[model samples]
Target: MSHRPKVIAGVALAALLAGCGEQAATAPSPAASAAAPTSSAAPSAPATPVAAPDLEADPETVATGLDVPWGLAFLPDGTALLAERDTARVLRVRPGARPEQVLTVPGVEARGEGGLLGLAVSPGYEQDRWVYAYYTAAQDNRIVRFRLDGGGAPEVIFDGIAKAGNHNGGRIAFGPDGMLYAGTGDAARTATSQDRDSPNGKILRLTPDGDPAPGNPVAGSPVYSLGHRNVQGLAWDARGRLFATEFGQNRLDEVNQIDPGANYGWPEVEGTGGGSDYKDPLVTWPTDQASPSGAAIVGDTMYVAGLRGERLWAVPLGGGAPRAHFTGEYGRLRTVEVAPDGALWLTTSNTDGRGDLREGDDRVLRFPAG
Candidate 1:
């Protein structure tokens, strides 16, 4: 069947989807999503996956008057934490409510494209209550975990990734296997992407307690995949396939299917056709239409937030060209995520010093993806 943007997942499923990153107020929590997958390496969803939600053309404004908001992870209560890219502040956000500053992360050095970036709630949050963040520190990019009420310094889980005025890849998420995954930039140093020993320009996988994941392709190292320019988005399909959105050179932007130890040809290639040594991107967009950042997969379709393109692209996993939605409506889209209630939460990045700023330059929007 051809892909359509609209499909009903029912009201009950809608409520369930609205809490993708947050805890459910009534019953099980998002941490349940982190429960050890049956397969320590790969966990594919059942054959009969539920129908994916549709993406509504119009959207609802959730919150306003914010700086450049980047990382977004929801709480168990269906609320979310918003990371301000420049201010290094974390805020609690929900619809129809004013966003309140929750904490100011220290050691966040907001350079050109750095500062506080991605956020992820612990899948085992009920017991651990840990929140993870990726940000630019004084000397390098780092990943840290902390608790809202723990009243202590954040624990640096992973550090020593390169930092730069730009290309400090800072998107992170937990996979179905319950391991933490991070995308790092080459920090403008093209060689780092091809060097297996370098942490930059690669996707790193780690255990929840700051150790390298046991099943990583490289033993004793967090490097899961290598040879990426700058990966800003990571998501999994219903069948446990991992996809990542990347920022390329002026020539092309790409979305690649991530494989353990796979090489995506950065300094060697841009879009595709890198002989047999590198994996080609599943989808490629012009730099103007993509500069893709955060993405959220609902069923078979992946919705990605575009930065320079100023639009949202809905891609079909079964195979097809991506369709753009809300193009130019929300300036400089930063992040897009699926909510437990089956809606899509998108953040605008016009205030991030690169786009045209409007009344509410940087804001959060809710799309009816139910």
Candidate 2:
């Protein structure tokens, strides 16, 4: 686990999960409340109709001994890359090999819910060889990209989003449109979620070079949508509909249908205000049972990772209610990605100074789509 050097030495396990390596809630959204809750609500039912997904499978252990793995990305050749939150190291796992350290990111302040957070392999990886990441430093949170070959230093592409010990939103991915999208938190500032001018508490769209993506809701601005508090997951469906999950404050957690220029009620409303001025969540859960983290969409179902709920949730598309999978079986599911081979790749966060870490506490798991 020593990170004294830069290069990761080896590679480990590999399997093509059909479309893997791809890629909320709501309460007052942590924007209305400045204090973090000591405990979440008890597991409860989804607010809408609930039904099972078309596919479900038991998970198989893929890799172990990973300390606080947060982000996962897949290479063109099927190698999976993961990031450790506290260590700031990127590790690679190929097929049937031991997980080896790839490179240690420099200047990551591994404090609270920060450190090395999210990772995204370039869609043009075969040509560009760039890997993007979002992490926290002493002063703020930022996004940077580096060559996958480890030939150059990490270049800062975006910065200035506020950071806090807890609600530092850190999920980043490339949309089907090939634009880079990032989810951010309000940094305990309620006003930021309502501030269209600030990047904090918003879903941002940017070109590959970190400039605001063209056709944004506002001219010359990166903000795609505002009024979000601690969004950790972003995924797109077959129709290119963007979905995001947000951590709620105290009452309701939510899954929202993201639209450009749409204002998702944060400080103004928690779940559904039924007002035309704000977009409402497609699905809502008690903050306890669905502290949603990372997410992936396969077919008509969207798979969401639950942190406080300790379960994987499957939401049927077209506004059906969501159902929980693997309830309480895995401790603190942090991230879920669909593999290229049609399986789901999941990670655990029990060792992130929170949940009880059992044997093989922090590990990577694979669940083939049934």
Task: Give the root-mean-square deviation of each candidate in angstroms.
Answer: 12.2, 12.3
Candidate 1 residue-wise lDDT at 351: 91
Per-prediction TM-score to the true structure, in the order listed: 0.87, 0.84
Clashes of 1: 18
lDDT of 1 by residue, 31-131 (tens): 33333323246545523223454555567788898899999998878899999999999999998889988899999999899999999999888889999
Off by over 4 Å in 1: 1-40, 44-54
Q: Which ten residues in a row have the lowest lDDT in candidate 2?
A: 13-22
- Give the lowest summed-lDDT range of ten residues in model 1: 1-10
> What is the alpha-carbon lDDT for the whole of candidate 1?
0.80
Find the candidate with the highest TM-score and give its number. Answer: 1
